[model samples]
Target: MLYSDIADVFDRLEGTSSRLEMTSIFSDFFKGLDPGSLRKIVYLSQGRLHPDFYNAELGMADKLVLRAISFTAGVSESKMDELWKKEGDPGKIAETLMKNRKQASLFSEPLTLEKVLKNLTMIESAEGRDSQDKKMKLLSNLLMDSNPVEARYLCRIVTGRMRIGAGSMTILDALAEAFGTKEDRPDIERGFNITCDLGFVAETLAIGGVEAVKKMKVTVGNPIKVMLAERLPSISLIMDRMGGRCAMEFKYDGIRVQAHIDRDSVKLYSRRLEDMTSNFPDIAAELRKQCRAERAIIEGECVAIDKDGNMLPFQNVTHRRKKHGMDQAVEDYPVKIFMFDILSVDDEDMTLRPLGERRSKLNETFGLSDMIQLTTMEVVNSPEEGEDFFNRALGKKCEGIMAKSLSQESVYRAGSRGFLWIKYKKDYEEALTDSFDLVVVGAFHGRGKRAGKYGALLMAAFDDESGKYCTVCKLGTGFDDAFLAGMPDMLDEYLSETHPSTVDAEMIPDVWFLPTVILEVVAAEISLSPIHTAAKSIMKDNAGLGLRFPRFTGRVREDKGPEECTTVNEIISMFEMQAQNKA
Candidate 1:
């Protein structure tokens, strides 16, 4: 298929508001494609050369991209930088200039999607040791004389920022629509749950139809990609839910990490499955030295507090993740790896096993030793015991408690933040809560101290039944100057003209956003509001729910997505729980 053909379909998809329309757009286009090719098309639509877990980077940075932009658009480096600073995209800037070129159409080339796919593979293959120039040259050579629109997408492809708003979940929704299987979302999700690759899911749908995906099975050590999540100011509602005793563990304030260890070496991955082996070398070394089992996949949180016991805040742990000064970072911010659950061990995948069995296996494999300390977890018979532990956690400056079900049937479900593992924090029950997970809808231009960065974020909640994101809050607090300065750059990937399928709002922000990123928000309290869009008419009158004093918490929930954002149902449930307690 030609780039123009796909681009036309893409434009149509982007222009539509209805999910049904979006579904039709993709279904028609993909039905003609080979199953495997259709999958590749899905990945490319998101502007990613490959899935994130594979660590397939194009390895081209800004300076090299600037060189290509300079050559393609006939602009100086200084001028290009000026445009990039304002627009946050070199490709868009190049597009603007290319349109003005007298011979722009003459430069255009009729390229095929196959060529694009091949180029993507080449880009991923070219990595490490001075490949930036080569990558830039390849991109420049592809679009040296191309038209403005072509140049725009070419730059987007190489830069790994499509800016077309075609995110992973969007593709998932599109696939579901095309195949006419919202009822089969779970089957598709099962395919994804096992494969962890949307490309594979798309391909499976194309090749075998829905039946091919229905027969998928989970395999161990294949490293199925996990979907990210959004954070929530979890409360001690488990006590209310079960009306029975629950197990509680301190919700450590730190980075959530998944450790993949084999007999040879241990690798650490972030919740997003990004290779973070370098981030926590100390933990890696300790895992190798201390882990008893030859092979194990354990999930834990790392805090850059103290080895002795003092837990640092999430911000302090984030410092350990800086790429530069590896040795000093480990020394400055010593982290403690609190192992919670073991997913696999010694070539045996244990996630499907009962929690009781998994726990015993974990305890047997990694004893209470120096390198791996068991996360503080206890089985209790009463809600008061769990509540007492919750207080103790907060008293020690901890986040809160995680109430886990100890049933043998309770297994480790990755990519799922279900009631099986509920978190109970201090402010969860409060009307005006500070922390919640919100999708980033829009950002404001910086001024004064924030002159060159994002000032505030427009955030929203998820309404699952409606499958739309609803505006619930706007955040402008709990972030330092440094964090504020970094917001725009960090969120550049998510910037869009509309919200994700996970978002439902009548009031659109200046910029739309992909639902890929999740954030932990701090707010004053929940309130009834007519202006906000979340849960409109669900409450008394048309005054739906909204957060009064929403702010960004120090926590960056890299583990979540907008779908996992505080649900309208959850909010109503919490409100009801609060009223019952007060009464």
Candidate 2:
């Protein structure tokens, strides 16, 4: 298949903001692809050469990409840089320059999908002396064959910015439409959830059909997408949602990790599926020494500790993520793994098992030690007991208690967030019990002391049922002068002239955004409003829930996607809870 064909689809995808339409375009494109090319196309559609967990980045910096654009378009670096400043997008600059190239090359080769992917792989693998030059040459060679439209996407792919607005869920929908029926989507999604690789799932479906995809199981070394939790404001509500009896575990304020152990080998992955083995060698060694199973996949939190073995804040653990000074940083900020749940044990896939059973196996298989220990948990049958446990967790310098359901059907739903597990944090007990993670939909211009920066941000919560981000509050507080000054540059890539189709807001701002940046916010309480779009008409006619006195928490929540932000239903639940308390 030609790269232009993919570029044509990309152009159509870029022109529209509707996920259904994007999925339809991808489905149609996938139908014409060969089995061998399906995996490559799936990755390329996401502007990636491999699955995200692989972490083999193209490593093409903007300067290097500019050099590639200049070399191919027969333009100087300064000219390209000026065009980039004006256009604000290197892809557009590449498109413009390629269309009006000063020199016509004698050699013209049609870019193939295989060739493009192979060259991208080469770019990712390039290293040592003159690697930047080698990467530029490889990208330039691809651009030399690509037409203007193709060059646009090629440049974005090399620079690691697709800006297509199509997420993994959309691609999964497209795959289901192209290869199988809606009934087969669960199987396809299960395959992806277990493997955490869409390209591998696409290729399997193309070759082996839905049954083979359904046969996918949790392997020892392959990292399964970790299950996520929803949040409620109160222990009573959480206990009520979980059928009264539930296991409330201490919610540690640290890095969420998934450890995969296969005999002598152990690998760690972050919640985002980034490989974290090298960063936590001490934990890896502990897992290998203590875990009794020959092969296992367990999920836990790695909390940094003080010299006296006291838990530290999440900010202290951030230093462990650095590539440099790993050994010294580990000594300075030692961490302990608090195992919570096990997903797999040997040949058995524990994900399908109930949470109670999984916890039992986790406790039975892993011995408790200073470095490796099970999370502090207690089985509670009432809200009072749960609240007590939550208080104890907070007293121990932990975040809060995770109220998990112990029902027979409470299996680990990988890559999903539901009420099977709910988080009740320390803030939930106060007027604002929880901080919301909202996506920025728009921004207001600064005034007076805040001049030359964004004064406030219009934030929204995701409405999963409608696939839209609905307005909930405007954030103006909790930002320092430095953060305000950097707001424009921070949000430059996501700035859009038109409101994104995925965002629904009644109040307009000075500038609109693409609903990409996520901010952590806290508020006094949720109340019904006449203007906000979140949970509109659910509690009252023409009214939606709104946050009162919302303020930023200085957390960007970069690890979370827009779809993973606080949802409309959660806001409604909080509003109703507040009303009940007043009554």
Candidate 3:
């Protein structure tokens, strides 16, 4: 198939804000495409060559993309820059210039989807001294053969900014509509959530149908989407929800990492599936040294420690994220991995096992070392015992406690949030029990000293049911001048030309962003609002939950993904907790 068919679908998607329309449009096209070509087209639809975990980059910066457009369209570089100033989107600029190219189309070869993928793969692998030139030449070579529509998509894909307005969940909806029944959606989603690869899932579904996707299992190297915990108001509610008996573990104030260990290899992944083995080489080495099993997938928290081996604040461990001065950073931020749960052991999936059984296997798989140890957990049968454990965790400079269900059905549901596990933090009576991690979805232009930068950012919480981010607050406080000035550079990847279709916000801001950056935010109280979309119509008619006097907590949760941010259900629970406290 031609790449233009994919480009045409992207064009139609960009022209609409309705997700149902986007799904219908893509579904219609996907119904006719060959199964083998589904992988490339699916990845392109998501504006990527690989999944979120893999780190293949095309190295095409915005200026380089404009130069490539100038090279093949016969438009001067300065002229293309002028057009870019008028039209913010480089894809549009490429489209307009390629249409009026000085060179005739008769000399150009037909652009095929296979050719596009090959060039992109070469561009990703291009490195060394001549990489920048090679990337631009490869991009221009594609433009030389591309039509106006194909040129637009090529530039956008290379630059890593496709404004087609469809997210992964939207593509999932389209796939289900195209090939499988509505009942197959959950099984299809289970496959993706387990493997963390949408392209593979799409190809499997397209080729062998839904049954192929159902047969997918947990692989060792592939990072599983970490299962999440829900939040509750108080200890009594947790004990009541868990039938008065639960396993309480210390909620360490550190980075949540998953370690995949084999015979001689170890891979550590963050909550977002970022390869963090380089970030914490010591942790990787320790996990490898201490593992007794031939292969195991364990979850842990990487906590920084001081001279006396006491736990330090989460900010101290953030220094390890730096690429340079790693040897010195390791000496400064001496760390330990507190293993909590094991998902797989020796090629056998342990996620289906009950929590108690999984915990037992985790204990048996690894010998305890100074750097690797199991989390402190205790079984409690009453609210008083749970409260005492929570206090002890705080006394150890930890966040709070995690209460997990001890029932036989308490299996690890990857990429899910439920009452099987619940988190309770300190300050239960002071509005929200813990800080909320929200995604920056939109921003207002600055004024006065903050001029030419963002004044206030529109933050939103993820609505998992709808797969949409709903506005909850505007965060303008707690940012110093340095953080303010560096905001654009920090949030470069999420900048959007228009409001993303996956975001639901009633208030409009000067700039929009795709949900990507996660920030830790705190608020005085949760209140009902007429404009915000979070928890809309859940508590009352036409009123959504919003944060009052929300402020940044000076912590950028680089360890979390947008989907892993605080959810709409969490905000609603906080609101109810506040109400209960007042009562």
Best by lDDT: 3
lDDT of each: 0.70, 0.86, 0.88
Q: Roughly what TM-score does model 1 have, to 2 decimal places?
A: 0.83
Can you give the TM-score per candidate against the true fold?
0.83, 0.92, 0.97
Candidate 2 per-residue lDDT, tens place, 1-583, comes to 7888889988898888788898899899888888778898788877788887886788687778888888888887778778877776678888888888765477978898888988899999998998988999999999998889999999888877676767778888888999999999888998998998899999999888898898899987677877878777678888888888999999998989999998889999987677889889999999989999998999999999998889999888878888898999988899999999999998799999999899999988998789998999899999889878987998999988888888999999997888998887766555555779999999999899987789999999988766778999989999998899889878866776566666789999998888878999988888889989999999889999899999998887765667778888877766765666555
> lDDT at 77 for candidate 3?
72
Instruction: Give the Cα error of residue 196 in candidate 3, in Å.
Output: 0.1
Which residue window of length 10 is worst by lDDT in model 1? 227-236
- Give the lowest summed-lDDT range of ten residues in model 3: 425-434
* lDDT score for residue 144 of model 3: 87
Each model's Cα RMSD: 4.2, 2.6, 1.6
Q: Lowest lDDT 10-mer window, candidate 2?
A: 425-434
Please tell me which predicted candidate would have the highest TM-score against the true structure: 3
By TM-score, the better pick of 1 and 2 is 2
Distance from true position, residue 531, model 3, in Å?
1.8
Give the Cα RMSD of candidate 2.
2.6
Off by over 4 Å in 2: 102-104, 429-431, 441-445, 466-468, 485-516, 528-533, 536-545
Residue lDDT tens for model 3, 1-583: 7888889889999888788898889889888988778887888886778887886677588887887888777777778879977776778888898888767567678889989999999989998999888888998888889889998889888877777877777788888999897888888888888889888888889998999988888878878988888877789999999999999999998899999898999999998888988889999998888888889899999999999989999898888889799999999899999999999988998888999999999888899888898999999999999989998999999988999999999999998888999988878746566789999999999999888999999999998778789999989999998899889998755677777878899999898898888899988899999999999999999999999999998999888888889999988878888898777
